[model samples]
Target: MAVRVLSIDAAGIDLAGVALSRLEASLRKQAGDPDACVADFFDLAAGSGAGGVPSALLFTRGHDGRPLLSIAKALRQLA
Candidate 1:
């Protein structure tokens, strides 16, 4: 299987969040799944500095195996 990876490099800028949100939206449209989790597409994810915030939000799993927020959701709060 092909391994998909994602890397977030946020410098604490609103543009970063906006970009992430847009990316997730595009992925959803391409996959024909509006409710898709962006993280589900990636086998590996990494980030640094402020980027870590979104990386965690996208990849981190909760008790029920869900993240705290989606990329679009985090955009509103993070950006």
Candidate 2:
């Protein structure tokens, strides 16, 4: 079995429409209050649970003959 996870943070981008506002809100929330940001996006090939290593992942796509990419990650909490 395998599990895939994603964590988003201050890095990446700000784009048009809902994406921009959504990302902005997320950044603000993560900033305003927290010891660590647990909020993230994930896609699991197996079961879901709170066990995994935090790291970064990059996604790429093509738009109107142009290529676009973005960075995302699962940030580790440090005390």
Candidate 3:
């Protein structure tokens, strides 16, 4: 048996109408509260020893009350 995983370079792709809509929908869902603060997530601490690490981290929330990206919805938008 064999397995394969598909991945996309999020930065390499351009987002437009449908994609933007999808992203907004995902952001809302992840935040739970629509008013939750949202910001671009990144992993600055990641070691430079490796390549291909995602340039950005998945949307996440802060303890102060924020929402992260709804990964599932983001993937769906790509599809």
Candidate 4:
């Protein structure tokens, strides 16, 4: 089995959206999923300082233990 992971910097919640935007685009292109989520691709998420905001958002799980927030929704929350 393989595990994929992603790391976000401590760029603050405002700019975190920027990184998530770029991540959304890349995930969309690579995964071909209309609703791409960080939890789909990353088994583990880490952050530094204020990056914890997005790290928390990205880690939110549904009943099935999958990520609940779409990149758009996460973006909205960040906004």
The candidate scoring highest on lDDT is: 4
Cα-based lDDT at residue 53, candidate 3? 28
* Cα-based TM-score, every candidate: 0.78, 0.22, 0.26, 0.79
Tens-digit lDDT track of model 1 for 1-79: 8989888886764767777778788888999997777786788888878787778778877798766678877666664
Give residue 30's error in model 2 in angstroms. Answer: 0.2
Judged by lDDT against the true structure, how good is candidate 4? Answer: 0.79
* Model 2 lDDT, residue 72, Cα: 26
* Prediction-by-prediction clash tally: 0, 0, 1, 0
Residue 60 lDDT in candidate 2: 24
Clashes of 1: 0
TM-score top scorer: 4
* Pairs of colliding residues, candidate 2: none
Q: What's model 1's lDDT at 2?
A: 91
**Model 4, residue 70: what's the lDDT?**
72
Q: Rate the local accuracy (lDDT) of all candidates.
A: 0.77, 0.30, 0.37, 0.79
Ranking by TM-score: 4, 1, 3, 2
lDDT of 4 by residue, 1-79 (tens): 9877777788667677777878878987898987778778888888888787777788889898878887678778777
